[model samples]
Target: MAKRENIGLSRELRQTENRAEEEAWQTLRLLRKEGWPVRRQHQIGPYIVDFAITKARLVIEVDGGIHREQEVAARDVEREGVLRADGWNVLRVSAQFARHGDHLIEMVRAEIKRCCPLTLHPSPQGERGT
Candidate 1:
């Protein structure tokens, strides 16, 4: 059936993305297992977030600083604009974060603490209330 075929195609597409996502997920999971809740490769408007914590409405990107050249940076800035326009916080982690031990973990932890307060529970003072 056409529906079955479509499902198969969808599965294939997801698999392709999953492989790339896994590399990033492995690093994030290390922090998550320590108590920071994270979602792997979530979808935003016209983009797939490398990691997202919806509870904090934060998007975390594990970039290798591979976006070289002005054009690439411009595109990234534009993408960020789109994301920001939608009321989301963005965090870009570089090779230093995950490649080294403990440092990246701490950074992720701090970000979660910061963003979490903004998401699940908002306070009247324009910050999330505990």
Candidate 2:
């Protein structure tokens, strides 16, 4: 369980998140509604991600205008490398992906399937009828 203080902080962060972050949250919330176990503004190691799929060990980042800066880009690369080394798959999406619409969720679903094939498997009883 999350500490009450941490939970409050998470709520505050969500409330204060930028437009791109809010857009990403909509798509991530859709994933959660679909039972994908997605979380928003989740902390991992020393960093906080825009979204994360806990079971799949996947991190989704929504990059905005600041990411265009050379220093920020370099730091993002390093952050991704560290996450990768720690056995997490990172997906970086542009803010435009969110502003455009549901395409972003589709992309995330595709990445989830690619990274965690077990998510696509049929139940032990066997494949269900079409």
Candidate 3:
């Protein structure tokens, strides 16, 4: 019961986060064609990720200006600590994915290839495997 409530509250917070991270992920999603699985506003237990590829050990965090503030920064650092302990490497990007488009996709692809090359597959004939 308590866990369900926690999950509900966490989802609500994630909804808020989605509005904040909108721009960053639209650009980032292109990496999916490149073979990295991208999940938008994904939840892990109580924490919600802005973008994550679990098997790749990569997490893309889109930081709005609000995250730069001292209090929020501290919390984010703590959040990173917890995530790191769980074996996910974090990458922070700006809010441009939604604004500009597809820029972060290549960046995230490079990071995943660098961090977890074993999971990458070569795309053929300009199509990603379904």
Winning model by TM-score: 2
Over 1-130, each residue of candidate 3 has an lDDT whose tens digit, in order, gives 3566756765776567554466565566666666555776666656777778766767888887888899999999999999889888999876644355555666776787788766547442333332
| Candidates sorted on TM-score, descending | 2, 3, 1
Across 1-130, the per-residue lDDT of candidate 1 in tens digits comes to: 3555555554554466533345556666665444445666556666766677665677877665565568877887898889988988888766455455456556766776776654443332322331
Would you list the C-alpha lDDT of every candidate in the order shown?
A: 0.63, 0.78, 0.69
Give lDDT tens digits, candidate 2, residues 1-130: 3565566677788889988888778767766555676778777777777788876788988898999999999999999999999999999988888665478888888888899887764234322231
Q: How accurate is candidate 1 locally (lDDT)?
A: 0.63
lDDT-wise, the better of 1 and 3 is 3
In what order do the candidates fall by lDDT, top score first? 2, 3, 1
- When 1 and 2 are scored with TM-score, the better candidate is 2
Worst 10 residues of 3 by lDDT: 121-130
Off by over 4 Å in 1: 1-24, 31-36, 118-130
Clashes counted in candidate 1 amount to 0
Pitting candidate 1 against candidate 2, the one with the higher lDDT is: 2
